[model samples]
Target: MSFDIVERSLNDGTPVELYTFTRSAQVFRYTSADEDVLYQGATFTAVPLSRPSFEQSQDPGRKPISLKASSGLGFVQQYIASPPTDSISLIIRRFHTEDNTTEAVISWMGRVTNVKFESNQVEIQCEPIFTSMKRPGLRRLYQTTCPHLLYGPECKFSKPTFQLDAAVNITGGTTLTAASIGGEADGFYTGGMVEWTNAGVIDKRFILTHTGSGITINLPFEGMVNGDSVRIFPGCDHVLSTCVDKFSNEVNYGGFPFIPTKNPFSGTPIF
Candidate 1:
């Protein structure tokens, strides 16, 4: 035999309704004075009232019963409704103020349409709207070592990569275009492609000013378009190198670069 139970705690003078199932052989338990009794589960039908409260007269269709308490109190009223089905619907409403003004009377409705008795789960559906606004420059974006937004000791990964898509604009300093976009895990400087002039390489920098916007540096690579994306691949044992800032200036490896060999068995071999 299996059963389900729902318990609600209320402050003094709060009105509530108790709905239950019939075949389950349920029970009602309450202890508190100054409590106004409404419907009792003596019979499997709706009970009549001489002078109904505001909540009772509102819902005349589903025939919901009510209980009103005066002082701080608690009560439990249990009764049987219908048998279990794949879905059930519940509606809830609220008032805006204590005066019960027609203009000030705000009501809300919510429904719990589904329940899984075996798993002790429920699904509630509702429609409500809320909004908020804020000024610019109030938010700062940071890329952390973990996808879970963890930092410092909590971050287990050795190196984390972050990419900026837009062309960073600065006011005063020179423009430092990256050979490749993205910052290293441990290095102070970010690496980017610089123009190879006959004399030497020219470095770029950016400095902010009150009158003008930031400076912009254009990259020379074909695929490295403006606003193009970049990614950081963290170091992993047997996967990524753990040298951290070791590759900051090193672009190509090995003094003598090796070229790929052609397939020897591609054409017919001479005897």
Candidate 2:
């Protein structure tokens, strides 16, 4: 029977939901059923997961949805303990169990925005993808510091060209000791980034400080230990001097180095 007909009938169908969460190359699938479900040749593991009612809006604004899951679930610890640097997108599908061949319809699509813990459940808040399209774009700022994001298209600089190879010799909470990290000046990599593979996933963190062979990161990767290989990249302070000397890309510098410090319009600024 067709899905619409079965869905409209009160006692003719058993409906189930499938939730898929994705980030970069990682994908997690869950099924709202007693046992695992196989659809489209992929397995969606059954979990204690439920979503509140969500609606589509005619207005050009954000329509968010929330997913509540059992805290005891192992996957719940990931969001609670350490949120990923990249955004995680979600796709929900609904189909009737009465017909195995019937295709599931997409019920909702969004990206996870925040996670909250309540007693024994975790609530994941998500915002619709359309909301991002409705937001304003970036505007150029009249400031001394370059407003272009590092490694972004506007910066016109290649990140891999300045990347360095290193290995962890020791690790503290959010600090790591690596001999290669000290190859340059103390603050050469202060605003730079570091990344390593953890459990087959690429984990990244920003350098908070760099001194000698010790460097602190904004966050520590789970299970990071000594002997792990890591990639480090040098940072730019966004100054014209640094751009010319360090990166040799002053031609693409985005800041005005000679902006007047003293305003001539001020009453005492005639000299």
Candidate 3:
């Protein structure tokens, strides 16, 4: 007797296509290359909402499903350690022999709301893409528009001129001193992206501000350790000056630098 479980395409010798998706960068959408990082062999479970006894007129809509899978060997550590922001999409395809054709079937397609990784397994909680549009609660007051540094419709700034990677030395306890990031230094790390290659996720972010060949940078709570592998991207304060100096795109500056700080509702300036 053959005991080997097989995942065969319904259409005779056809193949089944499986896809899992997650954002490569915290701010950017997934790219073709990001597809290379999707989790493998993820099992999906969708549960139907049970009807309430008291309500007869209302129909029990389809509820969100649960997807459980193992973090790929490359992404296990970061998936467990960092806060949840990674979004996931799952889709399955199978061929139908009777129809003489292949069709796509998706289990879950949405952002990851929660993730529990343990014992070499990862459990993910997700909602449909449309779920975010359903705002059942109150909205908050808008103070300012936070635009993406580059390539956002609001910002429209150009990409960075350079990319930097650094090795952390044991010297800087937690503050990330000058000596720790090699002999070379620059203040560009402030507002930059901090990514550790070994880390499966992105969480070592910071709004760095420093001195003496050191740029102050936002880092993880524990900061960097000896020989920690890290990469730094140039960050901007989003000012007219920085825009002109760094990216050379002052005309594309998003913020209103000339806007008065004093509240207009509170009357004119003291001067």
Candidate 4:
């Protein structure tokens, strides 16, 4: 595939305009109105071109030159010495492929003095660029109909123990936050915590621990959420905080180093 220059113009007599094809390839020819021209193939190899060098070539009353090249895989020839302020005309030719496909070629023409050949190709330099992270859609199983546990003073320490079962397949680091539905007032209970145990392990010691005080969970790489169930041991009273209060720490509540809420029925305490 290649592109060709189909038209040319001048803007404010400073920058020369060359309209080239966006797709395919073709050859472009340039003709001068005045002065004889000598042609030469660039001796340099593929050196990159820079934008700054072209800006310095804007001068009035200088020798005018033109360039021509084949549309696809063709040589570029440069002309030297013509009318200083004269505009050049060009003709573009497209080549056809063996598969009956026609391709347009693109060519860039600037003042011969403005053109620079570092090696054979134009060189480009750029600064570092930044990108944003992409997140996947939330996974749903069992039609989102699972029951939730509520932790608050109203339930006291006499309520029945609640259980939660969740299975998550983690490809990278992930976080999971869960809370009670609506047994107590909104944001009335302390967030729950997670204690993880590897599958098939006989020991009861948790492998990883996470706090639910913020109702937010963060899982690191190689993280697994198998058929895990959180068993809330009853006979324990607790409190929850609002999303805002949890972040700002506005109140002077001193519930740290969790203390078990007193049982209303048994008059005993569980932590």
Candidate 5:
């Protein structure tokens, strides 16, 4: 029977919903059915997952959906402890059990926004893909300091060239000591970032302070241990001199450093 007829039939309908969450290279699939389901060559494990009725609005502003799942699940626990740096997306599909087929139609598609824990269950909130379009566009600012993000497209600087590779020699809570990275002057790496692998997952943290062979991170890396290799990148102070002396890329500097300090519109003595 066709999915349309099966879906509309009162007694002949058997339905299953599939939920797929993806973050970078990791993909987790789950099904609402009692048993595991295989659709499109991918296995969707049966899990204690449920979602309430969500409105299908015709207006541009859309409401978000919520997925409540057991926190006891391994995948749920991992995401709760340390959320991935990359954006995690969610795809929900419905399958008609009568024919074990779906028209490959996506019921809901969005990205994970927030996760909340209540008792033994986790509630994940997701916003529709078009919700981002409602956000206000960016407007450039007139400031003395560079407004462009480091290593961003406007900065026009390659991150790989400024990165340093080293292995952790000592671990102190949220701090790591790597003698190889100490060759650069103190504070050279402040405001930069560090990336390392932890328990087969790539973890990243911001550099809070850097002095000598010791560097403090903004967050304590979970399961980080000694001898773990890491890559550190240098940070920019966003000053005109630093742009010219350190990176030597003043051509791409986005700051107007020579702006007059005095109010030009006011009736005052000209410099």
Candidate 6:
């Protein structure tokens, strides 16, 4: 048996919930309010697309959901203001009511195709996962995961031993100022990662670039108000020297540090 929740399938599921959602080093989770003690008020209304051709019998695909941002939502407003610095690879899956055991979820993976901000809401359109599968995969090229690029088994990067959290004193405009964070004004925090929580709802992340002045950040955010939570992570340039000197994990370095940049065809031979 199947019922429709916001025009989407609620097929034979005792309880509906997302399994895992990880983006930009942040994961998506629920709160207490649901029967399962989750965020019960949170709703995902399915939106269906209009049928253009009568010749086609089947539906185009599953309707897309418009991302709504309230005063305290997990996904922020500024993210929709502009596309993220890196390409988005969001993976979403839903579990049926009774099949809510383990590894029982559906795929809703897709790429953001269109975004239109409408008065307190960011309506987005995404192409289906089949669109990605239809394209040429990384068959002949060097393939690697994000963990390898950041820090993983092959990268041999060790997480810093110290704390990275900071206390925000002032927040307005694109810059954020902190007073004596972790005992370093702007030295250690430079080039580090900043994970911020806004209004206890959405979480925004930005790479803290050093401005050579005070404890000011380069990236701009929407809800950069005072008293927001911020966590910092030590930066890694991913160079062979940096790996060897700071992390001392050069043995498992994933990059070819000695690869020459000089043109291979620069030399000419005379017969």
CA shift of 83, model 2, Å: 1.4
Comparing 3 with 6 on lDDT, the higher-scoring candidate is 6
Which stretches in model 5 have alpha-carbon errors above 4 Å? 59-61, 198-201, 265-271
* lDDT score at residue 255, model 5, on the 0-100 scale: 92
Residue-level lDDT of model 3, residues 56-168, one tens digit each, is: 32431224545445465333234544553335443333222222322334433566566677565666555556677788564322333334445466566543445556565
Collision count for each candidate, in order: 17, 0, 5, 33, 0, 7
TM-score of each: 0.15, 0.92, 0.51, 0.18, 0.91, 0.52
The deviation in Å at residue 112 for candidate 2 is: 0.9
What digit string (tens of lDDT, one per residue) describes model 5 on residues 18-130? 89988766788999999998888899999999998766568422668888899886556656656666578888888865664545457888898888889989998889887
Could you tell which candidate, 4 or 6, scores higher by TM-score? Answer: 6
* Tens-digit lDDT string for candidate 6 (39-135): 2343333322111221332443344433433423344333644545444444454445343233334445555555566665555455555665567
Cα error, candidate 1, residue 260 (Å): 34
Candidate 5, which ten residues in sequence have the lowest lDDT sum?
A: 96-105
Task: Give me the runs in candidate 4 sitting further than 4 Å from their true place.
Answer: 1-160, 169-172, 177-190, 199-215, 218-271
How do these models rank on TM-score, best leading? 2, 5, 6, 3, 4, 1
Residue pairs in candidate 5 whose N, alpha carbon or C atoms collide under 3 angstroms: none
lDDT of 1 by residue, 91-113 (tens): 22221111122111123222222
**Least accurate 10 contiguous residues by lDDT in model 6:** 45-54
Give candidate 2 regions above 4 Å deviation.
Answer: 56-62, 269-271
Off by over 4 Å in 1: 1-12, 15-152, 156-163, 167-240, 243-271
Tens digits of per-residue lDDT, candidate 2, 148-197, equal: 77888878889999888888865666888877777888998889899887
Error of 4 at 129 (Å): 54
Candidate 1, after superposition: displacement of residue 142 in Å? Answer: 31
**Ten residues in a row with the worst lDDT in model 1?**
71-80
Looking at model 4, report the run of 10 residues with the lowest lDDT sum.
123-132
Better model by TM-score: candidate 4 vs candidate 5: 5
Q: What lDDT score is found at residue 218 in candidate 6?
A: 53
